[model samples]
Target chain A: MDQIMSNLGLLFEFPIVNLKIILDGVMIGSLFALAAYGLALVWGVMNVKNLAQGDFVIAGGYVSWFLVKTEWLQSLLGVSDNFVILLGVLVAFVVMGAIGWVCYKLIITKVIERDLFTSLLATFGLAIMMAQIMNLLFGSDTQSLKLEYDTLYFADGLIDLPIAKLIGVCMAAGLALAVVLFMKTSRMGQAIRATAQDSRAARVLGIDTEKVYAFTFSLNAAICGAAGAIIVMVWVIQPFYGITYSVRAFVIVTAAGLGNLPGVIAAGLGIGAAEQYGSHIFGIGYQQAIAVLLLLIILIYKLLRQRRLRQVLQ
Target chain B: MKLKFATLALAGVAVAALSSTASAADCDEIHLGSAISLTGKYATNGVHAKNGYEFAIKKIAENGGVKIGDKCYNFRVSYYDDESKGDRGATLAERLINQDGVQYMLGPYSSGLTKAIAPVTEKYQIPMVEAEGASRSLFNKGYKYLFAVLSTSEQYLASAITLAAEMATANGKDPSSVKVAVAVENDPFSLDIRAGVLEDAGKQGMKIVIDEKLPRDLSDMTAILTKVKLLKPDVLIVSGHSKGAATAVRQIGEQKISVPMVAITHCEAADVTGNFGEFAENILCSTQWAETLTYEDPIFGSAANYEKEFKAAYSEYASKKVPYQTAQASAAVYVFKDAFERAGSLDKEKVRDAIAATNLSTFYGDIKFSDSGNNIAKPMVLRQIQGGEYNVVAPSKFASHKLVWPRK
Candidate 1:
């Protein structure tokens, strides 16, 4: 209790510390928002809650890390290290998109028509398989790329921002913007949104609902892969680290509701900041616990809100 | 016809018994069992430890396997992947004893896994010589059947605290005025490390500014680092196995945390020097054994030779410095071999007694288990990553390089 109080006191004594925490939170939160946005799209369109969402992210990270480590690729490209790393994002996106399509055909397609529990269980199994396979391939070590970029420090170095993380956040924002625009303007995006609204109605109106489902699922995975590629440059990734991203995605999507892009982004940033604050006050041991608690709290709040709405109708 | 068939069956039994006796006279096999982490967070070090055991076993065989009463017995280990979970380790320990009929056992990777397996080994009266588990709590449990070849966890970073105090006094500051920060993972090993640091820091009357536990799936520790920046403590202590060490080094570099001293565990195991390069310089890493030590034995020769041979045998370790986890694991196997020979029997009771009375020297270190089952003859060494090389810098006696204080 005293440590918490003292930590809290430090924030008030140096208000700039708050900015540091929020900045760190927002930078990390943007990546979480990307993963959550993928989850929201999958859930909103296909109604298959992807329990393997985080594994997709980790697999993407490994893909990027492997590419960066390939000396032949580096020599063949004859480009700067930063450009090669950024190129990994594009590569991971397309690769994971193909993987996602394969998964949909092999596993997701089987579970799509089944009950919700079936999809959840199947994806959960997929998540475990993916984590284990990656562990076997990569030797179960935490891997990351060390970017040579400098950090921009401000406020007497109290608030420092790494150029690598800055680039990651910008890329994340750009990806989100591109995704939003595609969903708003593209013909396939309209068909996807139409299928998501009512699959039977779309099929009756001559839309290929099956194609829309595959494309939506693939797009979600591609988005997650790009986010993961960015994450490897900024942070570390391990075979077992996928579950953390999975839980965060669940939290963000649950809090924001499906089909709400702005809500998903806000909730992701909010949860990220809230976690930092909780860890700052309570200590870092409570970081995972804080994430889980926020999830519970959000669920309860939504339940209460729904009850009140039902009572009003009565 | 029935009488002829009975005679044939009797002849078959006699022939089988005679061949078995002949094979036993040639070379008998002593089966040992181990349930180590093979596919989880601890898999890296777990695989290293497994290779250590296998190497030691092969070396012993080449040195004319264990001879007890004019019979040569080769060691064959039955391994099961524990997946790095404590419950899984305990269940596998039971399976090894009850199902596989294994009489002797080898320890798992982490202290948590060791703690779980200790109870099962005790229940089954199995003689287990463990190498990887270092948590002080494991020793205090009074496990008669358990024997550890390495020093306890409390000793891992205790020397770091003493060094910090020594540096403070050299800087013309009162030892009590020194501020310390501790961040450890919330596991049996790291918690015990934290306990040791807190006790030592308390004895020195130093102020503990930041004490925190790292989360299990540790990817980032910037929250703790941000606090360290705010507090500006004299010494920062962290212990979270390999992942924690890697995360700390990466983030400390990015955050530009400039404490006077920063000490952590598992630098070599995590290969932080290789991964982070300049970022890993000047950091104190606690280790069980160093290859530069003068420890030698007939089987593995000197500690340095063991490194060379092990690397030659396991091509994966050719690029990185062999982690002490592997070295200690080989030492544990050596202890078992010595105990079995000294006992002059395959009886579990005799072997257990011999293990409890172990007092020998090996390539890893001198081994003499106290009544509490932890090796008391060996001392933990603290090494600093100087210019990407781990050079011993603490305890003065093992100092290969001077301590670089006030990490740049």
Candidate 2:
């Protein structure tokens, strides 16, 4: 009857949409991964989730927005508009690094080895406090940076990249690569990585593991701040949206698994794109629902797989 | 020594009795139970409502509380935080009614929470004074005990269509080709608004290009923004979480989408808190009060004063530098006190009937309950944030300035 054909119609229609969904998922997933890599860096090193990671990004973005609109950077440094972005990224890096250093030296350092729960609670508390402070300092409002890069147009309208998004993607990629290079090559980065794997072993090998941990946490925060600056080029930054970004980061790290930077970056882009495509298919109402569903499925799948292996052993 | 001790004991007894009579003669201390959301998402709305009540209580006490033929009663209030949750709100309402034995109660910040606690109020026969609630079903349930100070979501969203039609003509946009994309919150108030918007769309010849009811936590709106961009609609009307609306605004900006935005309900309030000064321009929204009200407004002239005093007293309680809930709360206090005074007693039925007869002006507005115990037709004002202030811009008469349309 109509039910069978309508059900059959979906069977025919789902493949075309399935491909589109996957394609869309990959695009948004990558972006989620990128944002998550920032959090993962902090988590893997200092064991702090960086609750204010998204806000730091948002604040950096507002700074960049001010730089672009008021051309204050041009006035201050006599830099061209082309150099404003580079200046913004550098500025965000230093500012966020300093903030991280202060936050750690004063607050986070005292509670580092207390317990996992303490760190989690402290960071989450810091996140809310920082959000309110941001509201007080800058107010609860949307701020963004406008760029002049032209949109990337493709045939068949399969992919149309916004100029700002293209720039954000490139900046995020470049920063993420720089982070990878530092982790791989730099002496401090090596010490941090060593400490992440084993703090006792790192200390035995003549590394000041405490310093490395603190620096790593700061570096992670700085990277997230830079990401915030970059993201505002493509997305809106709000004071209260730190929680959403944190959730997005959590989903990415969990979905892609830990320590996978490229996968993390891919997850961010994939999430952005999935939301876009999912909204198109299901009407934007179920966008968050889809992400929640994906996260739940993956989490449950992992749990079930582990259970099955346990059963086999028994 | 025994005779003197007896005389002194008698004197002490007389002093104790005299103090009791003196305390009774004041007859001014009236206890009110208030259950409001003091934290979480509903904190801002609850704090404001609480402030409105506080301001009214202060105003009344200064005017000798309330006069009931001869006796005047001063007000004292007790409150609990609902945390913006339905179960918690109902639990608090029960405690306020059963435990505290308050004759009247104010609050239940949202429709979900209000509806959850409505039965408790009915069971207790406590005349509940409602403000900032938007669910119409609360009134339609035939609960004579329930009363509201404002119109519900149905009337709120119906204004949107009328606004669109009126705005298009005034702004030099073609009314014939006006397209509205309704992106309302998935909440009950928003759902009702979405329905009303769709219902009125055909009448105004308003084409609904995108009718979307999104959840409050939609952080990734790229697809929705991209679709709305592709549709190239002239006007985008979003009705949802205030923070969500603010995010939509920033997303629209990032995409270089230059369409005028209209938000309904609490989203407008969120727009104020989320957008702040620089980015608050040109986004039209409907609200109960405009911060930039004239001297005639009961609360507007004193808003700055209230802000200063409230911050001094309840600094740890509230943060945002805006007013709405305070007016609702303070005025409710005044109304409750005035009505109780008119009724001449603290009896629940008499107070309910007196509250029903509230027709005069107060600190918030001229509030009067209809036969059904809701505001007869309390108006919703359309305001836009300009230079960090919410300016009234619609109904022409209440407008502080002419409409600022999108340049494109």
Candidate 3:
């Protein structure tokens, strides 16, 4: 008990270390929120649960990797190396958008009106297929985009910060805001909201609900693709890493509740900060476990709340 | 016409049967099975191991096979893809032993997969010779049927720490004053390496500032690096595999967390230098084998000759150098060949006994397993990346180049 108290005391003694941890967490949290927003968009608008959300993100990262490897943007278009990442982001969005549309037409369309369990299983299978296909095509290697950026240290080098991560977070925030604006003003955006409210009523009112659903799914893929491109520029990516991203998205969406944009952003950052602190306090091996534990706690809380509400109504 | 056709069919059947028996009569062919990680996370090293095993078989066959008593036996390998999963590897290992009637087996790539397959081999009482899976916990399990070719995981980073102590002593600083920080993956292999480093640090009386466990996927290292910058340890050691090495190299550069020396493992196996280029330079890495070593073999002439042959055979799939995993895998084949010839019989128990008493040198290095089934005689080589090439820098006798102190 004394040892535990000392360990806790050590964590509190260093305010600078805690600050750095929170900064790192918030930056990573923004990326999670960006991906989770995409997941929530599809879930709310189309009611199709996508287990392959992370795979789309990874696929987006790979698209950027492929472009960088070929030097296609630099050689063919004469773009500079610094600008290659931006072009890669655009390409990822379009490529994943097309893939998402095709997925909706083939697999998602059949299971759209069926039970949620059927959609879950179908997407789960889709996720496995995407992971394996990626392995076959890309050859199971961990790859990252190389950026020639300098480190920005503050507090006499006590707090080390990477310029690349700052750039990635900025890009993620900009894309997310653009998505929010599109949903607020565009005709397709209103159609999606209407469909989410009532699909039958929206269809009767001359809104092509099917087209809205497909577009919503594609837009979500685009959002995830852009998020993946930024992630690759910031960190490393592998073929089998899709599931972690999916789980983070699922956790964020469930905690924030459907269609609650502010809550989603807050929950995402909260999870990220909590993860950093959790790993630091309780060894790094339990980092992933913390995310799962947070998910369990939230579910239990929701179950208890529902039980209490039922008793009050009776 | 129908009677004539029937007679022709009967004659064809008789000829086929005679050919089959004639082929079976040649008892000079020895079959070995392997459930290798041909795909998934271990694919990169798995491909290397596969090529090395296949090349060794070809080399031995070219020399007219191994002579056993009055007969000669040629080696052939039958491989199944383990998919880099522990459970799948175990299932494939059992199928190789039972369904394929294989008497000997080669273990899979990673320690986790190897751990799963080791029980299956032991249960069936088949002697399994493996090149990968270096976790010390593996040997401590007391499985008689398992023999590993690579040095144990504990020795992987121990030499790197020893070199740092030597450097500190030469600089007129107290060796005990050398502070080290270690971040390792939370796996059996990484934990074994962590235990080794801690033990060596205690021996040298060095202080360990921060000893933390890295997550398996290596998703984040920023928090750890932030702490590392503030503490400023004399040496930092990182070990996991390719991904862990990649994360360390990348985050270290991004954070500019400069230390006096950094030694990492799995750099050459994962092609870390090839991927990161200048960022990987000046960073020391503990290696299983170096091509510059003066080890000689009857099959491939010298260590350099073996690498030349390997590159020539698989020229299209060129990296800067052949991974040490491939060489170790090939060396496992040599152990079996030597054991088969010494045993002078096809009996499993006799061959196992001969393997236990074996001592041979190959292009990889000397092979002499201790009572615990680890290659205790083999020493881990310390390598530094100089201008994107791996240079041997340790074990004084085998040092190919001088150490670049205070790595830039």
Candidate 4:
């Protein structure tokens, strides 16, 4: 009882500590939402759950790193470091998008014709393959890009934020906004949305469902690739780090449902905040556990909601 | 059948060439086997160990190998990839002994794998001296055939705590008033390090403000740093593997959580000094062996010589800094060679006895195992990553650089 009292006292006494954690969460949460948006896109349109989504993110990061390391951009185009970083992101998008297109043509199309379990297994195999390939190419070392941005401290140094993270968040937001606009205005965007609603109906309406599926998967890969590039700038990346990002994306998508952009962002921020608070209160050992626990709770809540809706209809 | 024939022909040609160079048939080869983590999570360190062992074997062979009872025998290593799994290590060690007919063994990468392989080596009555796997619990297992050359994991962060206490006294503050915040990975190695730090801190009468075990994935240290900021501990000690050390340094910079002193374990494995540079400066870390150490040997001449040779051999082996694991791994092989020479015969019991009664100094350190097969004679040195180089700053006897206190 005394322990509990002291714990509560500690909680109430240091509200600023909690606020600092929340701010950290908000920054990290934006990255999670960006990756989750990609996973949601593929799941909604292609009707195939990409188990290799995290590998795509890691691949994108390596692509960005490769471009930044190579001096071809500086010699050929005479660009600055920031311009090189921008070019790295663009190259990641193109390269991963091409790989995604090739993957769809080679493996994804065959798996899409099979059952969900088969598709899941296939993609899981692809995830393992991609991880090993990345390890072979890049070696198993944790890598990050060094950004020259200085940190920004506010409120008398209470809240500390790195400007590199701010740039990553801004790039993520800009890419997300550009994607949304493209979806709203582009001709291929209509085909993807129509195919997502009802593939057979879209086929009957001459929407070319096959092309939509391929484009959607490529687009998903490109988004994850861009997320990876930003993450390499902000956080560190290793060959085996893809699975954690995939889990977070899965959690956020499940919590927010499909196509709800605001809810995706909200769930991402909530998970981030909960993870920080959980690690703080329960100790840092429970940080990853909080994500798995949140996943379980969200799943149960969803099951309960479905049952309640059925009861109400009856 | 065709592939086997070709392989046999190639082997026969190689053997003929070896025989042409050798004068006697009795001096064929001396074989030692090991299960190393060549793949999986510990692959990076495992590759380093592999390279170290290979380099040591090459050096030994170049020096005309070991002389045993009027015959010279070339050293050979039969390594199996354990894939960084404990059960796999255990099973493979058994295979290396039973099926492969190997009499000697080298230890695997981590403490957990060492624990897994110990019983098998013990049951088979094979003497094994490993360079990695430094958990204190392994020494307490009462296994006679198992010997570890590396300093036990418990001593990893103990020196950091001692340094903090020393600095406190030097600064005209009571050592008892110095506060410590510890974040350790919840593994056997890191837990032992935590225990050592806590016990040492208790002896100094320093207060522990925050203590936390990191999760498996090792992400999100913001909360821990936030607490550190509010409480403002005198020293912040982080004990974990590469990922944990990286996370701590990365988040420390991200949060800008300042402390008077910071000491971390496994800095070389993480390449923290090289990767973080200025951010890692003045951060004291415990190392098993440093190139700057004055330890000397007959074959390698000195610690610096061994490092120079290793770099010259493997040019792409990044990090001009020699990790303690590589040096320790080479030392393990040297122990085998030393024991074989002392035993002077192809006898398992004799070699085992020689290893048990072993006391010698090598390029790595003064290696003399206690009754429990732990190297208690060699003390672990602490280094501060200064200007992207690991400068030895502790044990004043081995001090090559001055200690940076308060980390300003």
Candidate 5:
């Protein structure tokens, strides 16, 4: 308790510390928002809650890490190391999309329309399988790509921002923007949105609902993979680290209702900041606990709101 | 009917004679069992430890196996993946004992896993010679059947604390004026490491600027690092297994955390110097064994030879230094072999007594278990990573290189 109070006191004594905490939170939160956005898409369209969402992110990280480790690829491209590292994001995006399609055909298609619990169990199993397979293929060691970029320091270095993280955030924002534009203007995006609205109605209106579901699922996987790729450059990734990302993604998606991209982004950033503050004050041991607690608070709040709405109808 | 009966008896006698001759050619096997972390967080070191056990077993076999009275027996291990969870480890321990009927046991990877398995082994009266678990709590449990080849956890970073105080006094400053920061994982091994630091720091009357426990799935510790920056402590101590060491090195570099002295555990196991390059320079790492030590035995020749042969046998470790986790694990197996030979019997109680009375010298270190089952003869060494190589700098007697003060 004394440590917590003292830590809290430090924040007040030096308000600049708060800025540092928030910056760190927001930088990490952007990645959370990226993963959560993919979860939101899959849940909104397929009604299939992806428990393996974090594994997809980690697998994508491995994909990127592997590419960065390939000396031949860097030499063949005749590009700088940073450019090759960034290229991993594109490669992961495409590879994960294809893997996502395979997963849809093999597992998701079987679990689709078979109740929510069934999908959850299937995806949970998938998460374990993927984690183990990755562990086997790539040794269960934490891996990251060290970017040869400088950190921009501010406030006398109290608040320092790494160029890699800055690029990651920008790329995430760019990806989200591209996704939004695709949903707004593209014909396939229109079909996807239509199928998400009413699958039976879309099928009756000459749209292939099956194709839309597969595409949406694949797209979600691609988004998660790209996020994982960015994460590898900024942070670290391990075979088992996927569950933490999965938990954060679920928290963000739960707090922000399905199909609400803006809400998901806001919740992701908010939760990230909240967790950092919790850890800063309480200690880093409570980091995972804080993430789980936020999830519970959001669930209870939503439940209470629903109950009040039901009472009003009565 | 009489002719058929005679033929059957003759055939049975022939079979028995053939089986006895075959058994004479091949040595009898003494099956040992282990529940080590083959998957999950501890897998990296777990695999290393497993390899250590296997290497020792092969070496023992080539040394003509364990001779018991008039019989010779070779060691064969049945291993189950514990997945790095305590509860899962306990369950597998039970399976190894009850289902597999394994009477002798080898210890699991980390102190956490060993803590979980120790109780199960104790309940079944299985004698376990563990190498990886170094938590002081395990020794204090008064486990008669359990013996550890490695030094206890408190000793891991205590020398580093003493060194920090020595450096403070050397600079003509009071040791009491030193400020310390500690960040350790919230697991058995790391928490015990934290406790040791707290105790040592308290004894020195040094102010603790920051003391925090890292989360289990630890990725980022910028929050704590940020605090370290603000406080500017003289010494920073960090202990997590391989992942923690890797994360700390990477983040400390990225965050540009500048402290005079930064000490951590598991540097070799985490390959911090290989991964982080210059960023890992001057950091003190606590290790159970260093190959530079002139420890030797007949089976593995010498510590340096063990490293060479191990790298030859397991090419995966050719790129990096052979982790002490692997070296100590091999030592544990050697202790078991010596105990079995001393007992000269397959009786579990006799074997247990022999293990309790263990006093041997091997490539890893001197092995003399106290009544509490921890090796008391060996001292933990602190090595500084200088120029991408680990050089022992602490305890003065074991110092292969001078201490590089004030890491830059």
Candidate 6:
């Protein structure tokens, strides 16, 4: 009885505390939602899927980190890590935009009239090449930028949030709102929507559809860069990090469906929260299993739903 | 046109025929081959491993290498990047052995990659001086030529447990009374380390609150952080993560979990996370190499100066750090270089004997490769990340500070 009682103490003594975890998840997940917006944008505006969006974000993070560490941008403007990150955002968008434009002009345009499979393969090749170039240039060590943010003890009980995440959360919300406004009202945004809805009709209206694709890609790259800059304040950067983050973004993109911002945000938040809960219920040992399980569940559901529809049609 | 083509073809044939005959002269130089990763997912580990061997290669060449009594022969290396894949690693290993005729080898970044290349090493009968791969089974596989210079996961994790207890006690806490959760990255190495922790933690009467395996490349560890905070584990052990452990520490600090955390296998890269600033303090980790010892030792000071000159010359090439890889790599090459000199011959049997007889002080500590080529003397030390620098804290002989465990 004594031994059993002690073993029970191991099981229940440390109940999964919720507040700190949920808040941290939401705060971090918001950035995921923000970065996911970039992926959704390029896929929506340009019919070309960008497999290198996460690498673009990683590039952005590195740019800001380098600028702050090396004082490279000191002469142009006096700025802290925030300013550097903002600059990184600008640089990521511009550089990736140029790279995307060059990529399209060189390879994608050749496959534009071909099947979708050709374009997908081309984009994948681009992702791999970009990853290699990153390895070559950055040399694969995990690097992070520091932020001077205080930890806020809002309540005595449990919710202790890092001020950095609080800032990042607010910035992500602001960025997401900006993306919404741009898509709704901006002229280029309207051109992108027109091309997305009907590419021929947009060109007939003098939308310059190729320019729209390039601009949209640039915009997508810029948003990813912004996310990267924010992440540097909150997370760490490794060379292959883009591959992992890219997959995570793709998950939200698929779950949320095409051009649905709210759905994306919900999916990101839900995943972040669920991973937290998973750690609680299953122990930290199985947190990653949650994502794999979710992927499997969705896969099974889709298969079953399709089978049911096929039977009905039959 | 036919006559002109025949004349040009004759000249090309002469060039090739001459070059082929000249290849025989290459036999005078002994080439050490390695199938090290310099690209792909685990690119960082590969690149660092390459640097370790390079430092040795440079030293060997500078000293006119392999003084087999009367003859001082030039030693060289033919390296190819395996990109951290087993198939690629094995192919490279075979190419290095069969095609290039490399006799001695140092390699193969991880255990999985090492295991992949093990059969190739055996087939070639090349004596492999391996460092990096800590899979016990890699050595246990009854391969006579394969020798390792570091601790396996079981040995390394035992050290972590001992240090954890000592650290808690040093901080004036009841080391025996605690809820310790074993959180590890879900890989062979991580599983080995954390499983060891659970076994030891269970025996020590520390409640095993959580034991979970995570992905090797998880970008977001906020959820894991939140869970650990909720569990309020006195210690959270995230071992064998190539990249995620730093983020775990940052997230834990952001949430102010205030638990004394121990990150296994990745305390080496903590210096790069200046973004976490002072928040990264008191985060402890274990590794095979010691950086400051090189800075502090007089013998290493000369080597350090040599490294400084090299770094100054090669700053444009790569990131600058007294990397953990450099310590192991430089040691690997020096071990071979010293052995060849001591053996008085470049013969395989003699060099093998010399390697087994090696008992010398290295950057980490005193190192002596067992007859099996495993470093029996090198002990894994526990260190803490303070202001982005990993300061040794566990062993009293080398520790810079008494271990401090933070409590909320």
On residues B1-408, what C-alpha lDDT tens digit does candidate 4 reach at each position?
A: 999999999999999898756533445698899999998878878988988898998887777678887788877889999999999999999999999999999989988899999999999999999999888999887998998888898898888888888888888989999999999988877899999999999999999888888866665577788778777899999976777778777778767777989989777667776556677878888888888989888978899899999998988765556667889999999998898899888899999989987898998989888999999878889988788777999877888999977687
Give the per-residue lDDT digits (tens) of candidate 3, residues B240-324.
7777888888888767777889989878545777667778878999989988988888987789899888888888556657888
Cα lDDT tens digits, model 5, A1-314, are 89998898989988999998998899899999999999998898889999999999999999998988876687886877788789899999999999999999999999898998999999999999999999888887777777888888888878888898899999999999999999989999999899889889999999988889999999989999999999989888889889999999999999999889999999999988988999999999899889899989989999999999999999
Model 6 error, position B247 (Å)? 0.5
What TM-score, computed on C-alpha atoms, does each candidate reach? 0.88, 0.69, 0.87, 0.89, 0.85, 0.77
Global lDDT of each candidate: 0.90, 0.68, 0.86, 0.85, 0.90, 0.70
DockQ of each: 0.54, 0.21, 0.37, 0.39, 0.51, 0.29
Ranking 4 against 5 by DockQ, winner: 5
Which residue pairs collide in model 6, if any?
A17-B230, A145-B275, A146-B275, A285-B212, A285-B213, B52-B329
TM-score of chain B of each: 0.84, 0.80, 0.87, 0.88, 0.83, 0.80
lDDT of 1 by residue, B44-117 (tens): 77998999999999888877788788888889999999999999999999999999999999999988899999
In candidate 1, the residue pairs with backbone N, CA or C atoms under 3 Å apart (3 or more residues apart, or in different chains) clash, namely: B134-B153
Local accuracy of candidate 2 as per-residue lDDT tens digits, A1-314: 34334323442544343443454455445445656887887777767766766666666666666666677778898877657865687777778878878888877887788888888788888888888877766665455554556555443332455666655666766777888998899998888788888888888999997788778767866876777777666556667767766777887788777677766766676776666555665767777766777789889999999999999999
Indicate the worst ten consecutive residues by lDDT in candidate 1 chain B: B18-27
RMSD of each: 7.4, 9.4, 7.6, 7.4, 7.3, 10.4
RMSD in angstroms, candidate 1? 7.4
Cα lDDT of candidate 1 equals 0.90
Residue-pair clashes per prediction, in order, are 1, 45, 0, 0, 0, 6
DockQ of 4: 0.39
Give the CA lDDT, 0 to 100, for residue A52 in model 2.
67
> What interface RMSD do all candidates show, one decimal each?
0.9, 5.0, 1.8, 1.7, 1.1, 3.3
Candidate 1: where is the Cα deviation over 4 Å? B1-47, B50-127, B297-301, B309-320, B336-354
What is the overall TM-score of model 3 with all chains considered together? 0.87
Ranking by lDDT: 1, 5, 3, 4, 6, 2
Ranking by DockQ: 1, 5, 4, 3, 6, 2
> lDDT per residue, candidate 6, B211-303, as tens digits?
656666655565555546556777777764546556666666666767755555565555424546555677777777655443222233444
